[model samples]
Target: MAETLTAASSHGEHAHGEMSFWSKYVFSTDHKVVGLQYMFTGIFMGLIGGFMAYAFRMQLAFPGVEVPGYGLVSPVDYNALVTNHGTIMIFWVAMPVLVAAFGNYLIPLMVGADDMVFPRLNRLSYQVFLLSAIVLICSFFVEGGGFGGAWTAYPPLSAQSQYNLTPLGSSLWLVAVGLEFVAFLIGGINFITTAMNSRAPGMKAYDIPMIVWMIVVASIMFMASVGPLLAGAVMLFMDQNIGTAFFDPDRGGDPILWQHLFWFFGHPEVYVVLLPATGLVADIITVFSRKKLFAYRTVLYTVFATGVLSFTVWAHHQFVAGIDPRMAHVFTVTTLLISIPIAEMMFVYIATLYGGSITLTTPMLWALAFIAEFLIGGVTGVFLGASGADIYFHDTYFVLAHFHYTFFPIAIIGFYAGISFWFPKMFGKMMNETLGKIHFWGTVIPFNLIFIPLFVLGASGQHRRIYDFSHFPNLSAPWQQDLRILATSALLVMLAFQSVFLVNFVWSLWKGRKAGKNPWKSNTLEWTAESPPPHGNWSELPTVYRGPYEYGVPGRDSDYWPQNEPN
Candidate 1:
């Protein structure tokens, strides 16, 4: 095995040494580079989304005032900012960072493969994603100033350029979204195929790392649910430009059909991003807490249950959309039932941490925060899930608060956790832990402060879609306006503290301590490879002998056991 690895390493070095910069970084087929591309691009888009949030929140808090960085926030501008903010964060930021980037980077290394089964397809996926982002950005500069019908793009508003007032922007928005889905569809296939076919010899399905399993399941969920949305996007695009009224009720079409199509994928889309974040948390907590994952098979089963139940709950979103009471009752049951499996997964994570040697490292902090914060999201969701409560809460700040509670943990905190955990391996250097903890406290505290006020405002009957609360006498009261100001103020603090993270990330890349392989003393196969693994992940591929989480085996000298290590 050593001899084989030595020869392979020598060959990889020669080949990598001969490649030019463009071929190496730009057009490279290396999964790590492709993953880095996705990560950086996602981060860039996150900034745009954040800025949009700042602009709109400013409009809400201090109506008709010009935002500091962004100029005046007209109603049209407010709509555009809100619509694109949601769209960019979900499609561009969350999917890419949580699924594509980490999946591409971790799968091959953890599974003991040198590269993905179809390398060219992987490269094409990212290229398509980048192009889609560019198209979405360009829509902002077009004649109509971006789509204002909201990210859901409901018809009448989304289908008719007359209602939306963005003939060009709405179509471009649809096109960009369609292109983004295509990219993920391609990437999802690669993730599933590679994990299935490319694992090192003797690595059984049960032996796979939890993060890899979560990514694979997430990809499957995405592929399964995305088909309907893709078809809908095309139809909606045609409706906008080519005179099709697929979603136009006035033109002999059912607008509700678009809702069905959108939410069909939309609710599952929540779990799609969610499962990957859960997976990241699972791996991080287990490693940092120094314990094997509690009830590994059970966790997998619950994930499967969550994915299946995710489909049934989509209709719950339409309860207030004029769906039947009978139908709403059925969906309400399913929505409440879906919580059981997710709750079980949370308990399982807590069980794993119960008696373990807990380390409050940066990554560990983010992982723990994911649980605490997401609990608030899940508990609050029960209200919105019920038909009776939803009628009042729907489109209110309550729903918005519930959404941020869920997604902030899933996307933002998840990204920070995974990146902090994998920074050493990805960049061959250790991050500054002091700066990391500072960023974590700074970010998480403000996050809660921002959303909790929204929750209160929402319960006070403040609607989410309002351009200015001053227009509504009841919502514009002193107390309610104060909540808006508080939430907006918290958002500013959160955004400002992000610079600490930026400095830490950039500085640590070149100037921090050099990290050797297995900095975390992890047992996963990825940790067995070099820090910032080379073109070929390992000179000699690993052969697995055990499951990933094997901490504190009674008779072992070292506390953890690597999957590739043979007795």
Candidate 2:
């Protein structure tokens, strides 16, 4: 199989000869190029989302004050910024960077396939994603600015133009989101098909890398879950423009129906992004700790259980949405039950780290931080999962803080970990350790500083959606305002420090130490490929001879054993 693939790759390359710069980089069907396109585009969208966060956080900390680089933000602008920020971060940034980018680049290489099974389809996926991003950005310039009805786009406000006062923006937002979903659906098909069918000749299910399995599972979960959300988006778009009242109570439409559809996918959407990050962390931890993953099959089973249970817990988000007490209780139970498997996965990671020769490299630090920080998010989530507690905490800054704790780690920290670990293979250069560590501390510390204060403010009865708490005397206590200011100030510090990372990334690209293939001396098949692997990855595709995590084996000259290396 390896030889056959190699012959085909060589023939294709020879026939194509040298591609033009645009064909090679822009319009190429190569999985690697498409993956890089997803990555760079996601990063660019992240910057836009981050700036939106900056603008809104500034408005919250100092109401009625003119912000630098942004003028005085009105109530509508604040809502739009907050809404679009969440939308872009999740759909544009997290999905693209975590799933689309890494999945495209790593699947073929890790599985020893020549390319994605559907190469042209992969290119189409990215092109659609880029188009979705453009539509979303264009929403901001449309008549009344971007949609301000929150990222969830719950009806009456999202449905009725008079209520939200941005008919065009809302429709555009819905269309953009729907288009983004279509893009991922296309990409997900490619991920599942390639990982399942195109693995090296000798690689069995268990022999494939954990990350590849994870991405495949995530793709399946996404394809299964996103259908309802896509259908709901269509309904909402109709409600917005066609005078349809799908979610309008007065028109005999059930608003809660939208909640059911959204959360059905929304909760699972959390795990869709999360599984890949955790899988990435799994590979990273084993490599840095110099140990075989403890209970690899157990971890895989736990992930499957997590995915199955994830579907059952969606209604926990609607605990306070006037759901029946019985249904809320049921969802609460399932929600709490789902935590067990996640906890088991976390313990499995710790067991992998136990009694191993651990190296705290930059990637290792981010991996460790993901566990610690996401643990906080999970713990706080238990409170919101309960029907009783959620009644009080819903829509508070506490909820906001809990959300950031979870998603920031999943989306931001996970990206850093994967990128840091794979930087050598991705760019063929080693990032400066000092600069990496500096950026790590700069990011993680300020992250906590920003959110902890929000937790405190939320506990003090602060509502998340208020434009100005000063107008409400009870919510505007001096201490509460102080905490708000501290949170915003910390956000500023965090955003400013990101410049260090930008500098480090560009500088290391040209001036950093050379990274030959397998700089980490890891055992994955991807490590067997060249640094920044050329077109078609390798002259000869490798045959897998072992599982990915064969570290610290006895009677071996080397502690690590590459999967492609013959015994």
Predicted structure with the largest lDDT when compared to the true one: 1
Candidate 2 lDDT by residue in tens digits, 1-567: 223667245426422568899989999998988999999999999999999999999988899999899899999899899999999999999999999999999999999887888888899999999999999999999999999999988887888888787879999999999999999999999999999888887999999788888889899999999999999999998888788888999989989999999999999999999999999999999999999999999999999999899999999888777989899889999999998999899999999999999999999999999999999999999999988998999999999999999999999999999999998998999998888999999999999999999888888778988999999999988998888889888889999888888888999999989999999999988888889988788878888899999999999989999999998
lDDT of 1 by residue, 1-567 (tens): 435443255334333566888988998888899999999999999999999999999999899888998989998889899999999999999999999999999999999988887888999999999999999999999997999999999987998877888888898999999999999999999999999988888899999998899999989999999989899888988888888889887889888888999999999999999999999999999999899999999999999999899989988889878998899999999999999999999999999999999999999999999999999999999999999999999999999999999999999999999999999999999999999999999999999999999999999888888998887898888988888899999999999999999999999997999999999999999998999998788877888999999987889999899999997
Query: In model 1, how many backbone clashes occur?
Result: 0
**Overall lDDT per candidate, in order of appearance:** 0.93, 0.92
Q: Clash number for every model?
A: 0, 0
Question: TM-score for all predictions?
Answer: 0.98, 0.98
Note the residue pairs that clash in candidate 2: none
